[model samples]
Target: MRPRLLFASAAAVVAALTAATAPSATGAPRAAAAAWDSDLAAAALSANPAAATASGSQSPELGPGAAFDGNGATRWSSNAADNAWLRVDLGETLRIDRVTLDWEAAYGKKYVLEVSGDGTNWRPFYTEDAGTGGTVTAHTYPQEVRGRYVRLRGIERGTPYGYSLFSFKIYGGTPAPASTTRANLALHHP
Candidate 1:
């Protein structure tokens, strides 16, 4: 019975992976659901690589990619604009639970953490009006939002310079199908 159960579990995993990797009707590859404990912002994920972009950079060296590079020494600095913003493409739509903003000397006094399915339309999940800089961790736990693109829009600058960030880390889980979710819930409940 143990061997049979093992084989059944393996088969289920394989089928789930296959379905998750399949392309959608729109011809765009589907966003694979990731483990709830994993960091969705990590570029190391070969399946869905995350990328970062910004409205404007202070210089070529301090580009947007530096913020998501997982290197503390590097950072992304925006130009002198109160409305400067930084966005990250999570490669797949995810249920974002939390976000950590490691700010540099220059930070946003008033900013909004927004999520979007398309890059054009955005919905704010977190807003900081009295930002003291440093590191800010915003948890959307009880009420998580879903989107592929996450943006940090600055409304007011904390410093005389522009907004700067050492890192913009995102934490989320991939959404499961209704059937899979129900099955898991039933298994645990029973």
Candidate 2:
């Protein structure tokens, strides 16, 4: 019985992976989902491979990707007008407690971090009208949240200019990273 159960589980995993990886009706949507799922699945694999193998929702890659590098907030473009925002759909639920914004280019320095249970509605984790250093310092907003959608609203650019990006990451887990910070309070870029 035990052997049969293992065999069944293995088979199911293989089937699921195949199905999830399969191409959908349209190329773009399917590709996006596959890409997002792949990233989440990849992250989970390192944390827990077996759990990664078992979980679904490895579809929908509606998120941003980094191109070049920035020494300090120098990569974000200032072209985003009002309501013209970029967002990240992590593609799965994560127990996120903190979000760190590291801008290498130093242009899109000051930012606001918002988290949502559903992508449609978001609450602030950190907000800044004016930001601080354009260098390599981590601006952290600490909160206990389980969300699939995380968004960064670029309030103001570092050095009063907006550029592009190199990489944007969402760091999370149980109990959260060991740190001290206030809840939902506005902070300046230092």
Most accurate candidate by lDDT = 1
User: Between which residue pairs do clashes occur in model 1?
Assistant: none
lDDT for each residue of candidate 2 in 1-190, tens digit (9 for 90 to 100) = 2322112344654575576567766753332222321234235333442321101111222123331121233233434332224455555666564544544444454566677777778877666666564333233445456676666666565553343444444566434222211331223333
lDDT of 2: 0.44
Please report, in order, the local distance difference test score of every candidate based on alpha carbons: 0.83, 0.44
Q: For residues 1-190, could you state the per-residue lDDT of candidate 1 as single tens digits?
A: 2322112365676787798789988889985567767656655223333377889999989988878777789999999999999998887688898999999999899999999999899999999999999999999967769998999999999988999999888887766667665345343211
CA lDDT of 82 in candidate 2? 24
Model 1 alpha-carbon drift over 4 Å, by segment: 1-32, 44-50, 177-190
Cα error of candidate 2 at position 124, Å: 0.8
* RMSD, every candidate, angstroms: 5.9, 16.1
lDDT of 1: 0.83
The alpha-carbon root-mean-square deviation between model 2 and the true structure, to one decimal in Å, is 16.1
